[model samples]
Target: MQVTTTADPAEFMATAGDWLVREPVENNVLLVHALDPNGVPPGDREPVFATVTDAGAVVGTAFARSPYRMTISDMPAEAAVALAEHLAKEGEPVPGVNGPTGAATAFSARWTELTGQRVGNERAQWIMRCTETTRPVNPDGRPRLATEDDQDVVAEWFTAGMRDSGLSPEEILRRTQHMVGGQIANQRLIVWETSAGEAAGAAGWNPPLHGVVRPSGVFVSPNHRDGGIATLVLGEVVARALEDGADACVCTHFLKYESMLAVVEKVGFRRLVDVVEHIYE
Candidate 1:
């Protein structure tokens, strides 16, 4: 197997685009980057992209950059190990790796052997899908599109959500600044309001690709968690996306977040695959 590296998103897409869409759900992150207008080198920091080929046909792909853990797509175990060796040789300080269970496990193990960096933590993730959602019970508040006036608090909740999910501090800050505004401007983010019209929580979805839409994420403040805010907002967003022509909705969440699991369950998401995220020391 040969692993090719590139800093250009277009080049990377050109090389592995076909392989990526072949298993879109498993490669959702990469596909979103390829199909986005937010620019793939988010925060203007270039990511390390790897494309694996055997007999000159693309077989696998992965990427690593600061503020985000390395993530691999459907690939052979050997390809994943080869990617670990390639990253080690290039000397990128990958903070962690997350992806489909098999590739992530193979890559993390080889990375430990090659660079002596131990796996600091392993978080199991659930990839869930909703083809049709059950209507969420109303929580006294309704969902509305976020606007510029709501940017500050939305960014705040975005950061809080990232922190709660154990994202690195730099990542939380970067995404708060770079992503929140875009989400609002594109009308992709939703705000759940109180009966008095106060912002109680937020949720959003990516533009559909291959008939699939993935929720960017959802969050309700501590004081408002009891109101079922997340379920109501996310369910509305998914329902709207389906009405807008998306065939299905998808989301990835840590298994530890029981609240999120329950919220998703209330809206009819069923587990599709098991994912893993391994942190490095």
Candidate 2:
């Protein structure tokens, strides 16, 4: 019934983590942020975390850092509207909203109504989960754990992905530098290589949370497209997670990435939910 904001990730998790885990696949993003020990990485934009509570129980949750859209799990439309009002009232600059279909739409509409901003673009994100991964029978490349030597290229590719999402340069640097290094250090980031030693593609899985591991930062080199590199790397990573005891492997991708969709399906992924990201003008 009331919206509250915090700077503490611990508080965010303490309040919202239980509700978030109720739908792990749908709330994977927030769960990652909440569980991340290396929080925010000195970004240019301040971090924001909020939860809607009624009688001491969390009912809705959202998190944001400027230059990046606010992200939430599924929540009541009224809860989403209250979140928009809370952010707007705080003079927080919300460039967009991303979440489940109804929640995202409600938040965007409320944000626009309060701020007089126009919705500019929208993207559909598919949350996919794979329990049984089908690796390439004869992949063009073989999977290997990334190393310090591979850091720059992996960071570069991930930054490019952040750019495509409209992230500001500073925020992109904060995220990729911190994220890529952490993933590589943990040996979770994997690169698919050609017999000739070319890095054809890369993918990584987060630490399992609630028995679910989300594979992310997936990318295939431009020259490697259509050679099944994405599927090769992703399948290998998810298969390893499952082998390591992950109950399910989840990931989200833009619906516009037709080729990636095909790759995911080939790796035995099926849709779990449809999410939306709405940008403002």
Candidate 3:
């Protein structure tokens, strides 16, 4: 097999699209394409690789970049080792991100042998799929579009969501602001409010794609934990997606979010897959 790298996002997306259709996952393929569109300049984006057989069939793929990270789609442990070895030899900086656990472990060992770097802590990667689409009864309030004036409040909630998910607050805020300012132009930030009109929960949506959109930043404050506000927010988000001509809405939450899971199920989302994220450091 031979591995070829490309900076062209179209080529990357073409390969990625095929991989996604063959093996669907929240983080591994879908979200990556949503975040980085084809035809766009690479910017700080990483290089993508397509592993091809001598007969000219694409076998597997991977992505890697500096200041961001590298990750592999589902592939054999041996392929992972070979890819890592190639990167190490090329002096490319390895990213501390996800891959299959066994593959990552094997590659890390190979990396250490080739580059003398040590593997750091490893964390479990969870991938949750949306199954059902139930809306909550008696939603506390209505879903409203957030305005520029609400930026600070939205930023705070975004930071809180990151903290709850064990992500870096600073990085979350930076990325949030960037997203909010860009392609998210079609997105609506929905808020769940109390009888007194106090905000209880919030969620964001990506613009619809192929008649589908992904829900993002779903968060309910601790005080609103048992209030079923999440279900309301989810319902509103799904409604918006439908109204915009979308057939389905998708989102992924860390497995630690039991409450969120319950809420999504209450509103008609069913479990699609359990995804695991492997980080390399």
TM-score for each of the candidates: 0.94, 0.94, 0.76
The number of the candidate with the highest lDDT is 2
Ranking by lDDT: 2, 1, 3
Clash statistics: count for each candidate: 0, 0, 14
Badly placed stretches (over 4 Å) of model 2 are 39-42, 137-140
lDDT of each: 0.82, 0.83, 0.60
Error of 3 at 221 (Å): 3.2
Which portions of model 1 show Cα errors greater than 4 Å? 39-45, 137-139, 164-170
Worst 10 residues of 3 by lDDT: 34-43
lDDT of 2: 0.83
| Colliding pairs, model 2 | none
lDDT of 2 by residue, 154-227 (tens): 88887877776777776787778788888888888998899888998788778888888888688888887878
